[model samples]
Target chain A: MMEITEGSHAVAEAVRLCRPQVVSAYPITPQTHIVEALADFVANGKLDAEYITVENELSALSACVGASAAGSRTYSATTSQGLLLMTEVVFNAAGMRLPIVMSIANRAVGAPLSIWNDMQDSISLRDAGWLQFYAEDNQEATDLHFLAYKVAESKEIQLPVFVCFDGFILSHTYEPIDMLLQEQVDQYLPKFDPAEKLDAKDPISFGMYATPEYYLEFRYEMDQAQKRAKDVIAKAGKEFGTMFGRDYSALTVGYLLDDAETVIVAMGSVCGTVKDAIDEMRAAGKKVGLLKIRVFRPFPSEEIAKALSKVKRVAVLDKNISLGAKGGATAIEVRDAMYGSMIPVKGYVLGLGGRDIRKKDIKEIVSLCENGIGDQFYGLRKELI
Target chain B: MTLAVGCRARPGKSRDNKTGSWRVFKPSFDHEKCSKCGMCQTLCPEGCVHEDAEGFFDPDFTYCKGCGICATECPKEAIAMNQEEK
Candidate 1:
């Protein structure tokens, strides 16, 4: 049924349907509504689960680490500084291969402090061993959670999954989302049964010190699981689409690329604006297209390269920059993946600290690609510099 | 190896793991001096020490790291630290 619901409530409703035995979180700007709604669900007996409001991000994730290790399906949500604070245990959860599903309301990391939208926070932790998925809208954000839990619990790829949506932009926006019935979700995602967890009757210690002999091997194994998870993601995504209507098997979706000379690549909610811009540019006879990256980690390099293999020029719009580097995280990864192809992929960093990225910005980026004048800061105010 | 091999979530499997090789010093027990007070058993870091049938405690060397905590805590001086055997 279609409902005009706040994005955060939609996500919380999805979590309720998934029936995670434990839901823990710490309140953070733009992300608090998600956990607060769930807290209400648990309190009113609407959802029979333990809803914990931990004092800080560290304890919130640490609580999830313990709950997931104890054989329960776990869910948590956080943003920006809250995410940065939990960085250690975020790594520990994946290092221990706990299948906990987390929602990252993507926001800008601050030196001066701004609670706003950006991809930097989650993008910074790209190599932390968790499967990362970026959503373009509230519907995708809600759907990705269902898909995330399925993929995380796959026997071949038992790892944590992060469902990331833009902070406030998507989290606070109200949109009509078609939600599935409870029975449909139950059929799609069965109860959490695990091959391993902390059972007192069958005690086993994890996160043990690996000697030099085994440390490298453990890391190597994490890499291999990530490589394997590529196939698992595709398979699980297909199964989900078959059961529901929205298919997401393709990691990179290209719009109007058939004979386009220039293509703009992006991720997260900004893709919505990019797509709208692409439509206007197409009407003006500009040979342009849009490529949206749905999954960031396990970085989908091969699929992305293949999608853009035919374009003449590629402009990457990154919402987060890797400081001291010439380009941002998404641009750096795209450029490296398309290396040796002679495509001249340009980097355009834009929308830091939730700066407005209008259609004019997307059009300008594409126009710069067309004129071979990109590979520079997007919408840069030279006066400010 | 496609699955995460080191990320074990189960409990009770620590018993299967061996840890004594980390030892540079091994604890040697003097049975005649032991009053069977169980201090060594209670003070063991690895939880591998056990009180045997006669109430005398012994460390399971298989998982003991030989940290010398048992010898330092033994009130009767019944335990001594020795270089680990080859």
Candidate 2:
């Protein structure tokens, strides 16, 4: 049944349906509402699970790691600083091959104390050995959790997953979500029976120090599992579509790209605005399209390159910077993907520290692409500079 | 030899890791000088040390990486981190 719910609560409703055994989270803006909703489910007996509220994000994720290793389906939620703090233990969960699902309310990391939405938080941990998924809207965000656990627990891919949704925008916005019924979810995501788990009766150790001789193999094995997950994600999406009505089979979605002359590439809630802009531009016969990336890690380089093969120019937008690096992380990755393809891929930085990227911004960027405008910042106030 | 398909090991009793081979200096307990304080047993980082029937602390070296803290922390100087014969 369809019901109007806040995005965070919608995700909580989805999580409740899946019946996580343990949930540990530390409170931060945007993500606060998510963990709060889960805590309420545990508090009101709506969800039969252990709701653990920890002092900090490190311990919060650490608790999830311990519980997950102990053969329990576990969850944790965090934002920018919280995600940063959880980094050390977070990597352990991946190396230990625990299938813990984390809901990342994508927010800007701060020295200036930002609470607004951006991709920097999770993107910074791109190599932390977790399967990463970005949602264009609340519905996809909610659905990715199910897919996250599915792929995470797959025998081939026993890795943690980060289902990232834009902070504030998708995390707080109310939208109509077809929250899956408990029975339907149970049919899709069966009770987690991890192949490897810690037992007092049959003791085992995980995340042991791999000697130099054995370390590279462990890392290679993890990469192989991620490669396997690319297929597993598609399988899970297909299965999810068959059971539900939404098709998430593609790793990347191209809006108006089949006959597009110019394109703007983006992710997260900004894609929604970009889609609206593409429609407007198409009405004016501008021959513009938007290439929205759903999975940034294990990057869909070939898919992205193929999507824009016919397009003349591409503008890659990033809500986060790579600090002192060349361009945004997505831009660098996209350029790497487009290597040898010879497409004029330009990188544009925007929405850092939660600055809004309206539909007009997308239209202007496409216009800029058509006008042969090269890589530069979009939506920057020159007066402020 | 073929490694496992994934990073996953056999999932129990990794007694074959042969971590004791990593011990450049192995801890050897001297029963004659032992006070039976069980300090070696408590100080062994591997927790592989155990009291024998005579209450002398002896370590099961199979699982021990052997940092030699047991020898270093022994109050009665009853333990020695001796170089391996090899």
Per-model TM-score (chain A alone) = 0.98, 0.98
Q: Model 1, range A60-127, lDDT digits (tens) per residue?
A: 99999999888899999998999999999999998888889999999999887999898889999898
In order, the B-chain TM-scores come to 0.79, 0.83
Q: Any residue pairs clashing in model 1, and if so which?
A: A202-B11, A203-B11, A203-B12, A203-B13, A204-B11, A204-B12, A204-B13
Model-by-model lDDT, in order? Answer: 0.88, 0.86
lDDT of 2 by residue, A171-246 (tens): 9999988888888899999999988787878766677666555779888988888888888888899999999988
TM-score of each: 0.85, 0.85
Runs with alpha carbons beyond 4 Å of true place in candidate 2:
B1-86
- Chain B TM-score, model 1, reads 0.79
TM-score of 1: 0.85
Q: What share of the true interface contacts does each candidate keep?
A: 0.57, 0.10
